[model samples]
Target: MEEVYEFLKNAKTWYLATVDEEGNPQVRPFGAQNIFEGKLYIQTGLKKKVAKQMLSHPRIAITGMYQGKWIRLNADAIYDARIEAQQSMLDANPGLKHMYQAGDGNTAVFYLKNAVAEICSFTEAPEIIRF
Candidate 1:
């Protein structure tokens, strides 16, 4: 879990894939990530289409590349309604404070559960981590 968090933190900009209402895949670049209560969490606005998609379909995938290596993660996005969870994410990513607050109705934080991530590079065998 720590390894995955480090890789994603360093990667800085990962892509999150969600399924739309029509069953089509939607992918977007995301930068917010953190570990809280031993779970990997991501931040977004509740009003965003991505959040709506995730609410309807919890299964999602994330992919990011850094330094010639890339990570592909599949997980269930569980929304955490607790303020502490929101605060933790905002604390980790201060820039989000400009647009989000812990108790703001628009702010949404989700923890990734049953996650399996594969880190791959052409020069080396893939490393798989589960959390």
Candidate 2:
């Protein structure tokens, strides 16, 4: 989890890579990545494109990259079951509330379960392990 934490904090933003049922890969840039209670959450609305895509295909990849340096994460996503976590994230980031809030009164928040992160230092070619 520490590596995951480092990966999240060090990278400016994660590029979320998702695949449609027909195998079309959809990649989007997301800015809010808050870790709470040992879980990483990406908040957004259910009706949004990514949310709808996740509902159909829960498997996704999130990657953080810079100047050939990167961390590729394999994760399983689920529509968050708890509102407290979502609210907590909103509380932490007051500015993004509008982005997370859908006009119809839906909160967009989801958890990426057990993100197994692979940190790769491209300049070195071989990856190093650190916790």
Every model's Cα RMSD, please?
Answer: 0.5, 3.1
Once superposed on the true structure, which residue ranges of model 1 sit more than 4 Å away at CA? Answer: none
Instruction: Name the top lDDT candidate.
Output: 1
Error of 2 at 3 (Å): 3.2
Least accurate stretch of 10 residues (summed lDDT) in model 2?
A: 122-131
What is the C-alpha lDDT profile of model 1 across 66-113, one tens digit per residue? 999999999999999999999999999999999999998999999999
- Superposition error at 102 for model 2 (Å): 9.9
lDDT of each candidate versus the true structure = 0.96, 0.72
lDDT of 2 by residue, 21-131 (tens): 788999988767667776777776666788888878888888887656788877777777577777777876677776664333567667778567776784576454321
Over 4 Å off, model 2: 66-68, 101-104, 123-131
TM-score of each: 0.99, 0.79
- The prediction achieving the highest TM-score against the true structure is 1
User: How many angstroms is residue 62 displaced in model 2 relative to the true structure, after the best TM-score fit?
Assistant: 0.7
